[model samples]
Target: MVDFYPLARKAEVLHVPMEVYLMFRAAGGPDILGQSAAVSLLDWFELDTEIIIVMERPSPSMDLVTYSTLHYPLPEDTVRDIMRQLVLAVIDLHNKRVFHRDLKSNNVLIQETEDGIRVRIISFGCGCIVSTIPYTSFTGCLSCAPPELFLERKYMDSPTSVWQIGGVAYELFNEDSKFFNTYEWFIDALGMKTSITASEEGKHFIQVCLEESPSKRISLEELERHPWFFTTT
Candidate 1:
């Protein structure tokens, strides 16, 4: 709600979720893309002053924050499970040229059913189509924002998103990592406010994600095949 676009530019911004859905649709529909990652956009309509968007309602579910709180100090296996699914979903989005700028845990949903815990990334209000050019504006959540935004004042697509994933993982292990500012992030190998003890590979993976230099950070493909992913669950 903080970032406001002119009324003339409403469609471009407000329609982000719908456009992304259509893009996923244009990519041979969700059936091909795997609808498990995101919620289905049932329909949409536009009026004079406002627009209405209808989306799927997955019941018996809760946001990741709530889930994590209920099960604080998540086991390495659970963290690996969650991160693996998250990485795949992000890869899917980027492959389709959709950049989910806002990817904090709050925006992710964990659905419980006979199928087990399913992670669904929600809230595309701050999303944008992928681009090579760096974005100057900040539509993402501040808590999980990339460090480059505070340092260089600009960030690209993949790097920032990867950093966000790292931030999520870090918070899962280190509760003190929440609502962290730029200076309050990690210092050395592990975070300064280290809480939980994780495996070496897991720690390495998280560190790589939070790497300050985008060039050194883990790429989405590398992140998917990351050793930590297969080490446990």
Candidate 2:
């Protein structure tokens, strides 16, 4: 994939996406859900104040946003399956000390095969290292960002990621409805909104992911063990 960024957007060069691709390579070049991540960097150049970054193309794929929008309100089983893979992908990134700060549906590339649907995380433009503590600078899709990011301007890695995962879950099960656009609507949704038709366990899973307090949010490891992901076949 080729990324073109106009230099006019910022006064100084910010090659965060390229840096993240390099970081992913250094961290064992992992693949999530059978799709490869930012592979070897292809090329980089500047032309007339525009920066171009060339990367290995993840062909024959669509983003999660596009896929979900096409198949809105996916079945509970399908949602559980997709969420399981997504959680595992996030866990892999966290274990490698890489924090994909801008984790939204658009950043996840989805590919369907005869075997099954798979995914690869892309667009690391806003990613950062997890060890770099006290992240006061917030960067990511505003709607998917955690409450702490909006409320305190600082957030921990695990909790913030959990919140973003919850946002993804919301879109998956809520017919592409966003979670945090308006304060009143969000409050109503959080209070177990009437429109929610998911099972109690499913609701609990999302609720844990959207926990207001970082310390209280569900960890990826715990999420992996959640019953929703282990329903009888």
lDDT tens digits, residues 1-233, model 1? 22233222325534333444533432333344425577766555565666566666677789988998899878889988999999998888888777888888888888887878888877776787788999988886776788888888999989988898987887788755464344567453344436545788877888888888888888999999999987853
Clash list (residue pairs), candidate 1: none
lDDT of each: 0.74, 0.68
The prediction achieving the highest lDDT against the true structure is: 1
Clashes of 1: 0
- After superposition, the stretches of candidate 1 with alpha carbons farther than 4 Å from their true spots are 1-34, 175-181, 186-193
Best by TM-score: 1
Tell me the lDDT of candidate 2: 0.68
Give the range where candidate 2 is weakest over 10 consecutive residues by summed lDDT: 26-35
**All candidates' TM-scores?**
0.82, 0.79
